[model samples]
Target chain A: MMDLTQPQWVKHVVFHPFEGFEDLRWKKGGTLKYTAVIIVALFFALIAFDRWCGFQFRPLPDAMFSVVPYIMKSVVYFFAWVLGNWAICTLLDGEGTMKNIAIYSSYALIPYIVEVYIQVFLSHILVRAEGVFFSTVYYVGIIWTVLLLFNAIKAVHQYSFTKTVVAIILTIAAMLVILFLAVLFLSLFQKVYVFFYSLYTEILYRLRV
Target chain B: MKNKSRRLLKQCAAAGLVCLLSFSAVSLPVSADEPYDVYNYNYLGEAVPSQAGYLAERSVSGLDLGTTALNAPSDLFKDKDDFFYLVDSGNNRILKIDSDFTQIVQEYKSFKMEDGSETTLKNPKGVFVSPDTGLMYIADNENARALIVNPDGTVFREITKPASTVYDQQLTFLPQKILCDNAGNVYIVLNNTTKGSAMFNADGEFIGYYGANSVAPTAEVIANHFWNAIASEDEKKYRSRSTPTAFDNFDIDTVKGFIYTSTSSGSTDTDIIKKVNPEGYNLFDYMSGYTWGDLFSTWYSGTSYKTKIVDVDIGDDGSINCLDSTTGRVFQYDKEADLLFIMGATGDQVGAFSQGNVTALETKGENCENIYVLDAGKGTVTVFGQTVFGEIVHEATALYNGGYYEEALGPWLEVLKRDGNYRRAYLGISSAYYNMGRYKESMEYAKKADASARYNRAFERYRSQWLREHLTQLLIGIVLIVIGIRLLKYVIRKQKNKKKHSEPAASGSGT
Candidate 1:
């Protein structure tokens, strides 16, 4: 039987992992400002990493880099922006100092980095596959799902580690919900953009400028 | 220094303004009563005087069942000794008091049967007094039968379904309420039928059936009684599956010469209640939607007041006190808006209380003087007098009823603001939202209601019986499909392994 009197293990296993590291302490009274800086730094770091990795693909420079690669990169960039925006606002809005907010923001991004590593590994193997489309689609699905699961955990903190791990196992569920809503919004925007763009193009044609 | 002082004064004023705003926000609930309309009745809170323009006199003289719960007793009956019997249904006992209610002259356990026999009464549902002979009638529902008793505690008769109706073990007769009329006739309202017998002058005799025929028995009656002729063939071919009668309970007003009964139809999926009168042959079912023509024509018009009733009683003076227990509220409609109060703070126990269920309602005196409520939960009789401001509050009954719902969204929402896990409050708020035409809000409330209702054993059983049977089959089909797929895959793999093994053996033998 576990000793009821000594509950240090739970404290160690759970709280300590998320506790502030030496460099992660509250930087100033302004938690929001700190979170913004950290997120801005993370975004730049991601861009740098993408650029470093971009050399290997080198999508024929002449062809405006295949639409697929640019589209995927853009999608990832948008998600990263969303993550940074939601996390900074949520974590730093109250008692969080900038440094404390940055710590939480950094912890949240761990899942994204891990997901990117997996994506890179899979791409290395499947870049030569017959149906490159299938591999890309599959990996994209995995990354999208991992990001949604991570975001949901950030949104709701009522569950324990076991429950959260179970939630991760059931990633497709949270993915379905977030993806459906995201798809719906994008489709609506696409229709509106198309309509407006056509109208502008027609007017420009008539003007013959 | 002057500029600094001016800035300080401005800052102080701004701080004071913020303080005032915060204080006002906190005080909103306490000040809610200031805007009370004369017609509005907020009885759920601590008893306060009704607003203005309703009852001029707050106290009733001589009748003091001190600390009693007669607010809306399920059933009321006056016996041979002129003693009014209030089924203090909440206290699980019958309170027998003199007409003026100055004293509780006698108290009887609801378990004592019609023949004065010792039989446990699970719940005393309704109380009735025969005007012809002053005999008392009590519907003891736990035992699932009606008991007739005399003023001296002698059980004259115990009414049950005729034995022939119980043949082949296909019987579903559950008695809910009873009513006695001036002509010495007794009517027992079952879950779906109003079966009764006309008694001879002062004697209990099975005279004949009254009101409508049974829904389940009509076809059987036709089958057995009709001959094997052309008529029989036509009857069998044209057998009608008309809907069952929807009465909830029955009430008789000897003075006014009318019988009142409440009927409800629909399953969990659908439900409706109707108030019906035998003499006028009138029925008021709210589910049919609002019929203004019927409302105008059927209302009891007085010199200055009119009442469109869903459930009502004719007082000794022929005044009506109708109950609208739907929406978890009992609205007392009167000429003066202040007199039109709302009761039943809790949604569970309502309407002439019979054990948490209000089964019947009656006014004690000729001027519609006192309203006696029979609450079956606490099993006590509650009496409420018309207050000077026309507000009526029954303290004990309110406590029991407060559990289901509060009177408004304000109290529930305040709790949610503090701690959201108070599940019952969510359900109550949901019902309030639904009543206010906020369907989306109602759906959210329903989710909470579902979560809380699942905790109740009876409700859980009901849901399982209603939904689980069909759902279980669908689940079983899905499981079978999964198992079938697994078995098919296993068989295919085994066959492939066998082929490989046989090929190796043949090749080795040839070598």
Candidate 2:
């Protein structure tokens, strides 16, 4: 008799991947506000993981200090995945709406956020030789997030395990196609802008003369 | 009036003569009286003008020895008796001068062959005197032969085009530089051959090519490999072949007998510098991804300029001094290939070269106290003597290389006093502090040096020590947290039970 819309239900969904997402799908357990907060928290966690982590674990160049890439990786990639999955699911006769799919995907990222915070804390205390322990926890968190994602997709779409896998693969392919189209469009616009700018410059030069 | 005009003309003539004499003296390019500044790079890899390193003592032009003004002196070799042999290639002669470079001991213009015929050199580029055999090996480049001369100026052996089946007959055997090992195995750097230096034995027989350059793994190479894998044999035959880069110059380390080669090509990055062992393998390839020369040219904007290493010289204390032709700078590294200092520049100053090619480098004295750089353009040899600061850095580097980290601490600190931007001093001091169990100070210095590995080691020790000192407190804190969590859970359950009972009663009464 627990309230399905409560923020605490995210913890339940993470621990009980098989039944928790199913209950969430049927009972409307996830809320948009809570999901948005979790996604934002994931973004901050990624920045902290990169910037404040131990030097041994941080592979990025120490000379550079930019967080825009981390933001694009977490926030932009998360939304892209949601949009890509939603676009794929429409063809597969998925029962979930785009809003529900986005909320579920964001809710599934809980384990990654928790693990990253723990890792950032542990990086200060652990040495290079003990990096294996940190890596294990880090990888386990990713695996847990992936499993929760699978469960969320399966429950929301009301699809079998194999069907969910196929849909996820199709979603990845669609994301690549979208990225290609985006790049093509940007380059085409750049060429058109250059052509117009040159025309305008020629006109300006003639007027000055 | 006529007598006064005649006296004015005589005075003008005298002044003109004095001006002409002074101009000729200044135009000579070899000035012994003018002091020259020597520079070394600091820790930040910036070329800072320092006080303790080499100063241009004197530039030996070999003009005083009554030679044709050392027309394009290509190579300089100091023999065991401290006699300097200048390979005056343009004059087709080798000038043997004394160590002080003031007196010519002997001049070898032509040598007597075994058949008693006099054979003169034609554009000989390199010369090396063997300490073990007391013989001279000269690279007769234009003649396409290497002459091994005896101490009495007789041609002991002549190494010409090899007739061996392994030696490609089509490839020209133009010897540019030559060196001999302690075992009398001759290594000749050919101008046209890319299969590495042609190796010869003591009997002047061509054994085979040794230490061939490895092709770089560029994008084109990878693409070619991919296409070749799927292409038919006919198509594969039409494909362009990948050729290895040829070495331009080389020098032999007398103690270890390791032949180090330098390629002056600006096009390729692979094998710009290499240390070849006796078995013809590049031992320096396992430097763990360390680049041999300057990673990026400071002069270029937005693009990186690769180093063109024209010559390499192993110093007396096993330091590798690589002469870069592109930047006209000498990058000196220790035995382990750690960059110690970057000296020389392309300018008209004392420590700089003027549009001239640095043909050769030689280190003299017990600890390589003096460095001689032969400039081909100016036809002069610049002698750089170590300054006090340079001496301290060298001493510290030697001690550090010899595994006397604790002993190197004093000199390393003294080096820091002279040059605060000296990265090597910071590294040396950190290592010394690390060995002395001063982990905190070691970490600080390591951070300053940007030596992350050393800093991590020190941090590990510091962290463990801190953990050990606070272990009891940490355990007590953990126990208190566990108890507090359990009590909180117990209180929450009791409150929930009470609420459940009251809610059920209230619901029953409402019904």
Candidate 3:
């Protein structure tokens, strides 16, 4: 509906994983702000799970005071995946754009984001012997999220399940290539900067002489 | 001028205080001034400086035997009679020194054989005195034989290399170390055999090799096994094969008769240390994958220096002392393989050993009051006497291992006071509190010790007790939360309905 709020739309899309993205697409799709907020919440959920989980269930060997790794895993990895999937889907004549890929993918991640907080809450109350329930909850959340992710990708790209799977594999390969290029760019930039700075220093030395 | 003088005095006092604080910080880790670096690996496998467990007393070399010094004593053993046996390999003799190191009780050089002929030992590397038979087992390295000599320097029996086809006829029998199990079965470590120690029965007839080290399951080894599985029989015969490193030295727990072996093939860390049973199976179960020696190797100019245990000695109190050849350090572990102390380092000082090698390790007295290390390069034995901290740690460890956890609480607390970084003390305290029915306190200490299993056990009981005490409150709290949420939902719906009625078109278009 036109009156559907952002959180309510996300909730509706989550419950209806199969045809959720189709309905969202019919309703002008999603915005970049919503995707960013979802990703930030995902980051926080992961941080809370690691930092506040009970000692019996491993609250990090040493409690991590820094959230840099969690931020990279959640926000940065999500963006990378979205960019990679978009690039692959575009070449495959897919209907999904970069924005739509990010939004749909983030919607799939709601299950995991919810599961982490619940597990974190239960970890403090439950003993290690009763971890079977905790583990079951985690597995259910992860499987549901993965199922949602597959369905979302399929619907957004308007492809068969097999084609969607192939696209995902290609997307992973694309992500690796992008990462390799990123490192290569960074190192080359450092070398160029060093070369220019050395030339400037030589010029200054000549002027001083 | 008088006020200025007072301010200057105050500045001087503050400056002196800062200096004092900085000096205290600098000297915090080193609790004592010693010749060598004494350290122990923490639970995270990082080496931290610790209070000395043993202080190197006097270096003994034939203390009261006048001009006759013990040259390159290869092995040191404390027999059941409390007498010390020193294998003077450089001198080509065995010296039976009294327990007090007061004088050389006896020396064995020229041995009268059963055939009424006399022979002298040539560079004997190992000696073990049996209390029951009153016989001495000596591994005469250069002579290529093991000798069973009587107390009066008479050769009771001589064991030469076996003529069995199982043992390669091409290789010479160069015995490096020898020992006898309670059944009078002799196990000799050959210098050139990876098949394991050559075993001989009571009558000195070769039985077979016993307790060989297994090859590490490395990637290359796994791949080799995979290929060997599919290889044809003819091809398998000519393929290069992987073999296990030879265990260099071993010791037996006189009480349990379990043979504990140490492999000096330093880089091949797998099976570097093992405690074997009578069935020839390695039974060391405590922290099975735990690295026994130094966690990190030091990189020199070209190569990394790793701790390769050349010798092992089982103490009377169930501790295992290992001697490293490269660093000349002694690593001592408790019965549970918890590192208790790390002593000795490479230096030319009296207490320090040479970097080239430290060949022997032995613990003495009823409670292991003194530890003796034979430095082959230095040619002197450095006696390490138990310090106060060590005595407390030993007592606490014994009581803890004996299941007298509650009694060990006091000593563990004392250890924590002396060194807060001692994780074992936290574990002991946690267990003590656990046995005393203080589960909450136990959980607190377990967290400090990083013992998740112990924390879980304690938390289980604590959680049950908590649930029982708060069941009624919990139910009420859940009911209240449900009602509160429902009420909030209704209030929000009412507000939304009012807003819809006020401006229906605007709300629908924007949302």
Candidate 4:
């Protein structure tokens, strides 16, 4: 609505699921500030799910707990999807920009992030036998987030239903390729750095001798 | 200051004395001279270093029992009278030793038959003193006969190869191990038979097979089964049928009469160890998914050594002690199939055994005080004495399994104070605390035990109690938070309205 504020728009889009992304695209851009908050919340949500969930529902960490994997799963993986989706959509004549894609993706992730925190809390209260309620709530959150994401991609790119599915599949493939290349790039850089460092050490040793 | 220091020194001496008294109070019958590197699998299936439950007290030969030196002893059995019947295969006789490891009670070398003929045992592989008939069931190995003889060298019944249609006519009845049940039914482990032990009725009649191992449902087996169902006669002829592994040795429970069998076949995973009831069904059907022997294999001398359980002996406390021929380790588990201790490994030392050989095992005393393992490679029986940690574990396990949780707590805690790596101690303590309604303490131990069911049982109670106590405060906190957010929103909106109204004139010159 023209009278609505930025924060109100967030609530409006979430409650109005199907038409939310469409309305936001027609009216104005989605808020980047809210998207940033959601991304950070995603990281915290993953950490809390792994570390703070009740002992009954979650496995005790087998080794020292590390935040690096959570960061890789949450933020890095999310950004990769954003980049991959944007790049694929460009070639497919999709109209969504990279920024818009990032915003909508983060907005769709809201349900999953909130669900993780709720599940963590519920785990403490429910016994092992009463895990049905916990799992039902968890799957509901996951399904809601996935549906929202599908809708967001469709609405943002102005695509039909089948076209959206195709685009989503291509985006996943692109994400994997991008991830592999990035790892390769990083490891190659590390090797090059090590090589120069060793050369330096060898020169120092020869000079000393 | 000098007076206070003097008092502190006196108090320290008293504390030291108290510590010394407690240490002596819990001193073990087994000394610190353990001859083997003992280990037990934890909850994670990792072999963690553990306190030796059985120390190698001493290794002795047949000469130690006032008999000739034993040669390649194959089987060892302790009867109700606390006498050991050692099957000296090399010596071709059965030597009955007294309870104290001191002297030979009787040497059964020859038996006067009912037909007025004197027959001597030739390479007897097994000897069982039947509690029901009070007779010696000797497996005359090389002679291909089972002799039911009295303890005084008088033979009662001699069983030879049966001429029955059910039995293969070409197969020789190489009776390797023999045992007679309460009803006088004799079950004999044949040297070459995959169809299970050859069962004989009280009248010495050839009965049907009993307790045959089922073929493991591996991927290939399942695939073959699927194909065979829809296969033609020609296709079926081409398909290979899976054969079940034969059990090599078995031990009957003294009290329950349940026969526990062990197969030395290391390739197949199923039916490695079993507890069969009188009805011919495995009592361990519920634990079929569990791996009874060492889950991991080791490498020695360029050959992969996997644990192949050659013999199984049920101890007095209903504990199952399995002897692994490849690793030469005794894997002892409680009645509930929970692994308690792993003792001995293959080496040239006094306690260690030589790998890749047949071994015999027997436990002596009420609580399995001494474990005797007859290593054929060295031709000696290594006697292992129970340690203090083992006593505590046994006491705790008995109480815990008996549902006496409160009483088990003390022993389990004492076990923890000795070996913190003992995973069962954590589970035992957790269960005890759970039964006592100490939910918080139960959760702490449950987490350490890596137990989800027990942890959840405790967490549910802890959460409810906390929620009940803080319900009103939680409500108040929620209400305050909602009110504060509403108030903050109202203030912000009002300030924005003022700015919007005032900025209308300056909107044309916006920055």
**Against the unseen true structure, what C-alpha lDDT does each candidate score?**
0.46, 0.83, 0.86, 0.87
**B1-511 in candidate 1: lDDT tens per residue?**
9999999999999999999999987854522322232223222222333333122122221234654544334566655445777665445567777876567777777444544457645467677777666667777766666678876777777765544422222444455567776666666665544343222223544444444423444555456444434356567666543444555654565665566544332221111222334533434332332211012112235531222223455555433455433222244432111123444323332222322244445566444556655433444444555543231222211221344333556655654554343343465576555555454465456555443221232223333444555787878899999999999999999988898787876533421
What are the per-model numbers of colliding residue pairs? 50, 6, 0, 0
> DockQ of candidates 1 onward, in order?
0.01, 0.24, 0.52, 0.49
Q: Output the better candidate (3/4) by TM-score.
A: 4
Q: At residue B50, what lDDT does model 4 achieve?
A: 78
Candidate 3, chain A: TM-score against the reference: 0.87
Candidate 4 C-alpha lDDT tens digits along A1-209: 34456776777677778998898888775778988899899999888888888878889865787788988998889989999999999999999999899999899998898999999999777888888989998999999999899999999999999999999999999999999999999999999999999999999999999
Model 3, B342-399: lDDT tens digits are 8888887766898866888899876688899888776788888998999999999999
- Model 1 DockQ, alpha carbons vs. true complex: 0.01
Give each candidate's interface RMSD in Å.
29.8, 5.8, 2.2, 4.1
Scored by lDDT, the top model is 4
- Docking level of model 1: incorrect
Q: In model 4 chain A, where is the ten-residue run with the lowest total lDDT?
A: A1-10
Model 4 lDDT per residue over B1-511, tens place: 9999999999999999999999987663233465565677778888777787878878888778777788888999999988988888998888888887667888888899998899998888888989876898989988999999986678889999999999999999889999988888999999788888999998999997888888988999899888999999999999988788899999999788889999999778778888998777787887633568799887869988888999999998899999999878898988888898888878887778988664799998767888999998888888888889988898898899888998999999999998888998999999898888788999999999898888888888888878988999999999999999999999999998898898877645532
Best by TM-score: 4
Off by over 4 Å in 4: B1-32, B225-239, B464-511
User: What local lDDT does model 2 show for residue B198?
Assistant: 89
Per-residue lDDT of A192 in model 3: 100
Residue B398, candidate 3: Cα error in Å is 1.2
After superposing candidate 1, which stretches have Cα over 4 Å from the reference?
A1-209, B1-83, B88-93, B98-103, B109-123, B142-145, B163-174, B192-209, B212-240, B264-280, B283-312, B324-328, B333-341, B347-360, B378-382, B389-511
Give the Å shift of residue B21 in candidate 2: 48
lDDT of 2 by residue, A124-199 (tens): 8888898898999899999999999999999999999899999999988887887678679989999999999999
Better of 2 and 3 by DockQ: 3
